[model samples]
Target: MSQGVSPAAARGLKYRALRALFRHFGRMRPAARLRLGRWLGALAYRCVRPRVKVARRNLELCFPQMSEARREALLREHFHALAQSVVDRGVLWYAPPEKVREMVALSGYEHLQRQLDAGQSCILLAPHFIGLDAAASRLTMQCPSGATMYAPQSDPAVDAIVREGRTRFNDVHLVSRRDGVRSLLRHIRAARPIYYLPDMDLGRKGAVFVPFFGVPAATMPSTAQIARTWQLPVLPVLSHWDAATGRYHIEVLPPLEDFPGEQDAEAATARLNALLEQWVLRMPAQYYWVHRRFKTRPAGQPKLY
Candidate 1:
């Protein structure tokens, strides 16, 4: 017997039906996802021109001395890279571990090993990059005990798909941001090691506004707090995908041995932000520009958003 569907349920069914139609079209063959992604990337670059224009404006604002043509080139490159990242999600979710491994070229695994060997946990902070998802999946496979944060999705079906891919490497514990302070602190105390995205504006509560790329970008304070409170080593980790070399370089910066003790909390956060800025500047196109990074303006200022 079929259950009667409510009006809301019927509407949801219609929406899902449309979404599934597209998904079926985009994911027909085994390689369809990859092919569709490349096509979508190119299409997005052509049709959605405003986003790229804004990115150009951002680059110009940040680098005033650069010529207009150079900024346009950066904008085009950034849009294409971002589109590739979007399309790559299909591969990240469905590709086999062996296939995924070939795409990344990791450089620093020794720092992570040293921390674990000492019976201590470390936080791996990686910003937005193409190889980031691959690195996280790879890390979990290599380090079973390692845990990372997961942002719950609005769509239950998509959430399930994401969770399945992320956890397939190993049973990497996925902590929810809703757990507030307790969840992260608990993981640190147990030496279970967690990964987090430290960049972006997460608001004033869990974050402290700091100078990122010479502009104020809100940064998560959880990393520094846990490191100081639990006395855990803070390792700055970034995975860069070099197209020229056709490999991924995962670098682990030296542990922030002199953190927060000599300075205030905000200052320590600023130091980390500075380091992240350097990494992003190295590969500007890889960084996420869609993020309204300067949205949360200071109290007396006008809203940028």
Candidate 2:
């Protein structure tokens, strides 16, 4: 959910309870907090079955070649990662900045630094992962400034918390999805790297049908357009929460060579989707599967979700 509460989701209860829970959770030592997170994760796994059902269908569509038994196992592991990520947010949101930096282990940061050092704007192609917020929030600790796209939450309290968490450090610009690409360009022009996520199913406006895990999913093609417009390089970044060690691993990969091809959105969109597939293979359980990725069907096709 990227800290954004969906319209249909249960609201006041979650944020209010977590607000009180995190107050104490933030005070606990890392090891102890993680232990409690795992316990809460177990409880969430048992309680949030409806969302689990959505994730299950997503797995069935993406990994049909894998055995059903294996998918079930992966599903269980995913919930554990999901719940652990939420619990760790107490540190991301309320704990000291030093603790936040300590908990996040970022690799390939030099790639981003190299670009910024050379006075070039870079775009971080971040796919949907449970540890995404952990990675993004941590990046702001070291980055001078940056901007990212997000769908605003419906509830005021939830939106305030999420906005505060993201902008706590670096005064990073938080552009609403309704604000469009112009706001992003302004940030890039100011030398702030745009943290871009193009994997979600946002319907047919600026998106095209692309093979995400071999399924024709509606995906935004704007990554290429934006890169081409600004003459910037597109580098991929992926993050995952390790439940065992209670640490977030953020990998900022090098740029995709010859990106923003002549076909631009179409070809570039396909390449991005292909990259997401490869990343999903590495951390299958860590990918965000609850989203209705293939919600936008082509001309006459029925919905997959």
Candidate 3:
């Protein structure tokens, strides 16, 4: 009788293949890697029409006043940015720390340091920009100690790689979503800044419908709740790609003042959405448009995606 390899063995083989590919890409010159990424992105834009459609729909929803021609152009640019960021992950995950640091320029770090120096815990409100992973890696170098929650990848091998790559550079704790908010609060209370991404639609649970680009998006109120409950400062951190220089710049804005004081979760969430709109306006193509951000519609409302 012939026996087949187990599922675990098959997964292991796949993980090894992926790891080898990442290592190969990691060794290539940055310029060449980025060029290749752009080519791949262009190819994907043509082949993966569904994602393109989703992106286009998102643009239409967000920018109703903009002409269709302009939106299409932005959509193409967004794909390029998205692909570059994904391909660049090879460098971010496997490259030398010094090299990675060189590729990123950070501003407003003083704001973060001041909070740490004051012995205050704070929240790093990071949005879902294309360069988010790069920015997070860079922040690890400057941050004394930090912790963040991550939604685990379905593939165990991929999940392992992500966890390893994220924690490799800094003293950062990765909390699982299953662990819930309590684990995050425990880390924050220990004076480790929580690098929170509060801009996604994870459904209505622990979220409220707020205006994102004038559309009622299912926005998480956790950021406001966390800050208000713990009296922690909430700082906005945004990352941008400098195409001219082929580098990333992370801007850490100062803490929002007079925030969430006796304010309901919905009110605070709306304020957060307004700030995110400002950031998106500055770099429309850089924001992650492929995600169905408006997927979780209010009760009885038709799906936006």
RMSD in angstroms, all models?
5.4, 3.9, 4.8
Candidate 2 per-residue C-alpha lDDT over 1-305 given as tens digits, one digit per residue, 9 for 90 to 100: 13344453335676666566766776788788777767776786688887887899999999999999999999888887887787778788888888888889889999999998998888998988999998888888878888899898887666766776777777587789898887787788888889988888887887799898888998888898889888889989899777778888899999888887676578888988888899899999999987888889888998776
**Compared to the true structure, candidate 1 yields what TM-score?**
0.82
Q: Write model 1 residue lDDT over 1-305, tens digit each, in one string.
A: 11123345345654456445444542444345445545666687688877655566567656678788887777666666666555554444455555556655566678888888887888787777656776776677677576777787786555555565567665577777777656776667677767877766767665677877676766777767776777777777777755443345667666767765667678888988777767878887777775667767666867654
Worst 10 residues of 3 by lDDT: 1-10
Local distance difference test scores for all models: 0.66, 0.83, 0.85
Residue 216 lDDT, candidate 2, scale 0-100: 92
Question: What does candidate 3's lDDT look like per residue over 1-305, in tens digits?
Answer: 01222356346977677767777777888788779778987887898998998899999999999999999989888888888887777777788877787788889999999999988889999999999998888888788678988998897767666776787666788888888888887787789999999888898887799999999999889998899889899999999997666789999999998888777989999998999999999999999999889999999999877
In order of listing, the candidates' clash counts read 1, 0, 0
Deviation (Å) of 275 in candidate 1 = 1.1
Q: Could you tell me every candidate's TM-score relative to the true structure? A: 0.82, 0.91, 0.94
What is the TM-score of candidate 2?
0.91
Model 1 misplacement above 4 A: 1-38, 48-57, 244-246
RMSD of 3: 4.8
